[model samples]
Target chain A: MALEANYGMVGDFYTQNFTTTHTGDGDTLILNLGPQHPSTHGVLRVVVELDGEYVKKAEPVLGYIHRMHEKMGEVKTYLQYLPNMGRVDYLHALGWNWAYVGAVEKLMGIEVPERAEFIRVITCELNRISSHLLWWGAYLLDLGAFTPILYAFADRERIMDILQMVTGSRLTYCYYRFGGVSADIGEKFISDLRAFLAQFKARIPMFHELVTGNMILRGRCVDIGVLPVEMCRRYGATGPVLRGSGVAYDVRRFEPYSVYDQLDFDVPVGKAGDAMDRYDVRVAEMVQSVRIIEQALDKLPEGPFLNPDLPDRFIPEPGEVYYSVEGARGKIGVYIVSDGSPKPYRLKLRSPSFSNLSLFAELSQGTLLGDAISIMGSLDLVIPEIDR
Target chain B: MATLGQTIKSLWSMVVGMKVTGIEFFKPKLTVHYPRKEVDNLGTYRGHCDLVAREDDPLTPKCIMCGICVDNCPSGCLSLTMHVVGEGKPRPAGGAGELMLAQEVILPGSIKKAPPTGKAERVLDSFRLNYNYCSLCGLCVQNCPVSSLAWSREAYLVGRSRQEFEFDLLARLRAKAASSQGVKAA
Candidate 1:
């Protein structure tokens, strides 16, 4: 009864601010979903107000794993700050690597070699597929499916092995330099990738048959937490979340950085704008990524991996530039302001997960608590990316 | 009835899902029993940076006491202390051969070089690497002018305390050099 009284006070406060009245006679229970819970992905706390099983209001509190990456950029030199990109989003690290490097390259008026450009495309796409695979596995796990994650990890491990040959580190890859990539992709890497592509093509259909076509999965996902395209626009949600809302707006297609302009790939768009649509969009995007990687590998040219003439201390002239790369979660934009110094004057990271997670409260309103987890899963929120 | 048909269709779909796992049941297990079993291939796994010994002279380090790696380390994990060897001082027995060997290995086409000051010769006194803070980004190895530093490939490197990770690379190099010379003498 005392707990009910406290919950009533908290619910009333949220009700006044969020303007969602509790229709039930009893006091609405407040649930703190995580700052440590596994389903939240990584240290993301969601305070949900519930009337019985239905969620009245949901608020996501972030910054548990915040290490002040932007502040570190200002203190460290341009070359020194490169490793920080990998830590920002460990899943889709290469995208952040590309974003920071692309921004610096733009400011310095440096032209990356054609071969290096192709390598960047190949590696970044491979990373995107891995990110999506992990999401696919984790999302299914959230919905009470355990077998799919093992299969997902089986594919992901192989991809990580291929990436490791060139990137050096598996998870947090600081592979890309300002002018070009750190290492050249050898014949072994290329041949291994080709083999993986051939194998993964067959595996994709099996995944669909096992997980996608399951009636229970379809029941849980379809028509649940429908995020209309209008909400995506207002909240600035990009990547699969926007595509799931029937808006085929991808940063790779829209912005077209690196060798993405030359590569031919379809932007997968969903029709229903729901959890299932998001799942479908990510799955389709992975296929497109594989396609892009295949093309990039075939056209992989011969040249120096790193620019020979580039100085050890890469100092960009006094200028500011903004660069965006399509990460696994969404658009990862890096804005760097340099005062003709080795260290940045100011650095800002525009993380897609932050914007995508913002609309969760709005989307979670009046939905069942179970569906709330499904909506969160579909968004693919990386807490470190959001916090950073 | 329509409900009976719908139930059958759902059951059939469930059966179809079971077929995937059924097929995978006979397939070789992906899990590796660690400690006893290891992954066949490392696939360019980078562990930590270690000072590489000279090819011709196993007693000498190719690191010319240039602080490029020390200066460029993002995490400040690398620290170098350069000791200026005085002209007349009997150069630390077996040090002359090591210095000559080190110079021959490092001198050709390298950007950073010790000054021919005649009064003092720069020798790397100590090279400390804090493995705990190291991101293993390979910036130090990449920036090294003489290619002195390399990835260790020591995957199973472990310690009970944090202090064990603070490696004195120069001391390791000297110990290696001493052992090799002792083998030659024997």
Candidate 2:
């Protein structure tokens, strides 16, 4: 019944082939890779038809981790529904937080303080760095490389420590308020971040030495899961996935939100849209994120993190606004419609992992089973975000 | 099948990779063996919510019975039982809606009656927090008008059953106050 729900006719084998029902000479082997597989990374099931060792066709079945988050927005008040953003894309929870608040801020015409904007940029970039670090670890772990993940988590722990000091929660942070952040960055926050950055900058070269130049990674990744720029455009994939396809498009750069226009950093792009290219793009992007944070810290001003003037009962005027922020995976979007009531009339979350994972169905066709797995890993999918 | 140059480069890369791992392995371990020797910096760790006690009297909580925290909670985890005096209209501050004040609390010294105002006065009987359902979004702490709600550092909050997770925050505060008073008296 679940298979029937995923594919129109499960007994008929595939939509592409006209076999009149199950018996199509039995050349292909049907493989169900898992809603609980380690490589799928968080309850993502993909059913593929295999012609010997190569995948003939692939179908990705979603909704394993669905929490009905969009419906949650309609029932709950604006402030009440704010924490749902954190769980949507937990790796880049702050990005979702920014998108939701940014949308609400735009709808209500709420002005964020310059200092608050700077703080948002700093924390968001720090969060972006952390998200990328986890991806780097997890992606390599999927490709049968275990050591890189250990290094990745070691770096991630430091970021969690720095973020937990202010955000209160290490993961699923609901720290950013409508006009500004929940807590002000302390003196210790600045010093700790600066120390982490200085220490991290020296480690990037070591990462390049350790994982980037490894021959085994290169053999598995290079030219495997080759997603061209046009293919990425058709699939609507953004962030590093699209950037790895040699597009310099970034929400922070193209349509500069917050204080990204004020800050200077490069949008790292790659030549070939392969697993290796995405890996290189992410590593370079991490360097760029570090630069963005350092500059924001240098210009970090002193002010109220949360707007004191804002009313306790925050109700946006009857209108709709769509806000997009550059998350670590891709562009995170939040579309909110308010009816001048405390609760939102309608709310929609546009997660990048959904779009990035969409390309996998087309990209995995005719590839070896192992290479297809590598391609999926390259997408850096957070299943909860995709299923949300 | 590969060229000689390509093979040498691959071999060199593998060597470099091993060298990086070798260096990292020699460094002191970064992981914290928790539960044995707990993380030293539990100060920033946000575990659960607790009502902030008044500086003057530790037994007394600063909550004005405004019920902002209950109203602000998304998960509907927190519920307060209040004892109302006179015809219950709104209090001096933002008093909550008409509630079924079914059972009265037996705890003495917890109640504070209004000072001859002849107005609607609400006395907080119990502040029951179902931590099992609590999302720890910090809405209670942030919406607090009297600055009474705070994040407690009870990181290892383990329970045997679902009922054990249902926290009576007022009782916990009183126990903490009594313990401190006992220490001071001793």
| Among all candidates shown, the one with the greatest TM-score | 2
The TM-score of the first chain in every model comes to: 0.94, 0.95
lDDT tens readout by residue for model 2, A1-388: 7676867655433343424433335887878888888999889988888888998778888888999999988877788788888999899999999999999999988889989999999999999999999999998998898998888888899999999998888899999898898888989999999999999999999988987888889989999998999999898999999999999999999999999999999998989889999999999999999999999999988887767677546778898899999999999999988899778899999999999999998999999999999999999999999999
**Which portions of model 2 show Cα errors greater than 4 Å?**
A1-24, B86-118
Per-model DockQ = 0.37, 0.41
Docking class of 1: acceptable
Interface RMSD of 1: 7.2
| C-alpha positional error of residue A122 in candidate 1 after TM-score superposition, expressed in Å | 0.7
* Per-residue error (Å), model 2, residue A50: 0.5
User: After superposing candidate 1, which stretches have Cα over 4 Å from the reference?
Assistant: A1-26, B87-119, B175-186
Top-DockQ structure, candidate number: 2
Q: Candidate 2 chain A vs. true chain A: TM-score? A: 0.95
How well does candidate 1 score on lDDT at residue A175? 93
Q: List the residue pairs that clash in candidate 1.
A: none
For candidate 1, write residues A57-97 as lDDT tens digits.
Answer: 78887778999999988878788788999999999999999
Whole-model lDDT for model 1 versus the true structure? 0.85
Interface RMSD of each: 7.2, 6.2
